[model samples]
Target: MLPNKSDSRRRLNATGLSTGDYNKVNTDTTETDGFVNEQWVAPNVEEPIPWKTIAIILVLFVGGTICICCATLDWLADVNQDRSDRIGALTIIGALTIIPGGYYLYILLCILMHRTGYTMDDIRRLG
Candidate 1:
């Protein structure tokens, strides 16, 4: 047996929605429910300078400089295979550290100097 349309509508209305109500569009434009037509705006707060990152780069640059200098001095005085190998390894490590450290240090200096298009945010994004 088929259920009556009125009975079905009454059951749906009891659940707080009628069948035809789902198809109806809200035509009212004047109501503001606190969030209507809201646009997002970025906050105007300034980011703090990244002191830790700068410090780390400075450490790497200084450490790499020391490593390369010591390695060069050691190479000039050394004749043994073990010392030469150690000097070569130190030079490699120094180069690895100095390359990125120097690049980022240059970027940071540019940012500090307020060069156009240079930003600390770029360094932050690299990590």
Candidate 2:
């Protein structure tokens, strides 16, 4: 007999086990499938929030803010103080900070997307 696609997907979502494997275990029983058996259905566990990704997002926001401040300071130094040291140093630091901030933002976006059921393959396919 053919397996039902929606039911299989729902079972996978619940226990991460395929319907074929579930059927194999109950072959000797009177049941054709364990759909009617309460024991066969496992309780769903709550998925934990991605706290590290969230923390990284906050850190990236702060780093981006600092980078902007540094760029502003460099600009002020260049315009008023006419100092090359502050401008060069702050410019390099700001540029470095911006690269990582952008990367972190991308990671946060990926994390959020995955929570919404978009797998890495799905994300890559979209790109």
Candidate 3:
């Protein structure tokens, strides 16, 4: 024969055991209070300017400019086939040097002018 549910519940209660519903709903609505012992703050650190990188970029820009100018002048002064080939080579080399140097120099200028989205970190080191 099966035992009655009430008899089992009474026995459990007598033994100090709770057989009540475990999934009770919480109806109380109250805001929780939280506190911090100490507030955290970030340290202030300044980044130094990279002068050597700037100098290298400046040199490349100037050297490339001179190379292109000299090549142009030499090409205009003479129509010799050999000189034309040399001038073309010089012009290509000058363009290659000027591209990166000019780009970084522009970035440096933008940083100096305090432009938004431009920073010292934008300039890469050659070393």
Candidate 4:
């Protein structure tokens, strides 16, 4: 007489256990549980401000404004004194100051206006 399916399964299981003395332990079960509890994930961060660039811009702005003011003062002093040599010298100096100062001021304003909220895309677009 042939044994039933359950009887055959029992015989196979008994033989497998006897042949291999190693135990079947679920090691991954505890490791998976610990990983779920920890819940590790990366975070988002903001980009740093370009402070050195800003400092350089401020210096250029201040220096240009000072040059313009100095030239204006010299011209005014010459006009008061009523001397042709002094007037010619001061006029030339003032003209030189006005041109470069205006250009520098415009550049500084552009920089200030475009200061914040910049990315690689924005810089590419600026070109």
Candidate 5:
């Protein structure tokens, strides 16, 4: 036997939803109690320290600074016997070096913050 359409209309009226809106809302079978399930993408675990990468970066920064300084000294020692020209060139090199130096400082600061008990919750809040 078939159910009556009037009975369905009566039930929908009791819930205060029109038939068209009711059909639209009930089409998605996966959603439960009006809350849709979502996939969690971001990891909630503790961050691991990259010791080897950090060591390599620090070593590269120090070694490159020493080598560049020595090369600059040697290059200027051979040419431009004047003080003003060497000072100008040094200023340019110093400006260029600031970018990498700033990055190195940032990496060190991140490591220090982690050492000082910075957690993922704190990071999420700040971000």
Candidate 6:
């Protein structure tokens, strides 16, 4: 069964930690006989995605489309002004589609590479 949000919160509170609740940092070091305790540590929360990876992927996708559109705009503008514009429009459409298609294909390749169970030994053998 899937756990609900409140159940998780209760579990955290039981452990002396609260989730999604505002609380102040307890930096007061546990002490004994005027000696500082060094063993106590706060539990770790899940790490979030790094901003660099997100920026890279976002830039790649957006830059690819911007490149394709900028390249085709001139041809598209000409096509819009012409009476017999079927061939020109079709060519521009095909050019625009290639950018997104290539981006998706690269994403597919990354997924496939991750899933093939290609151990380091396998990669070394291929090389």
Candidate closest to the true structure, highest lDDT:
3
**Candidate 2 per-residue lDDT over residues 1-127, each given as its tens digit:** 5443223312223566655553223334343433544445567666555566556556755776686687687677566667766666766776666676666566657766666654332322111
Instruction: Estimate, for each residue in 10-45, the C-alpha lDDT of model 4 and write its tens digit.
Output: 122444456744333343433222223123434455
- lDDT string for model 3 (1-127, tens) is 5422222211223435566633322225233223222223344668777788999999889888888998899888886655888799889988988888899889999998999999787888775
Residue 79 displacement (Å), model 3: 3.1
Ranking by TM-score: 3, 1, 2, 5, 4, 6
Better of 2 and 4 by TM-score: 2
After superposition, the stretches of candidate 3 with alpha carbons farther than 4 Å from their true spots are 1-43
Error of 6 at 116 (Å): 19
Off by over 4 Å in 1: 1-42, 79-82, 125-127
lDDT of each: 0.71, 0.55, 0.71, 0.48, 0.50, 0.46
How much does candidate 3 score in TM-score?
Answer: 0.64
Clashes of 4: 0
lDDT of model 1 at position 11: 19
RMSD value for candidate 6: 15.8
lDDT of 3 at 73: 90
| Residue 60 Cα positional deviation in candidate 3, in Å, after optimal superposition | 1.1
> Which lDDT tens digits does candidate 6 get at residues 47-66?
54344544454554566565
- The lDDT, on a scale of 0 to 1, for candidate 5 is 0.50
TM-score of each: 0.63, 0.41, 0.64, 0.33, 0.38, 0.28
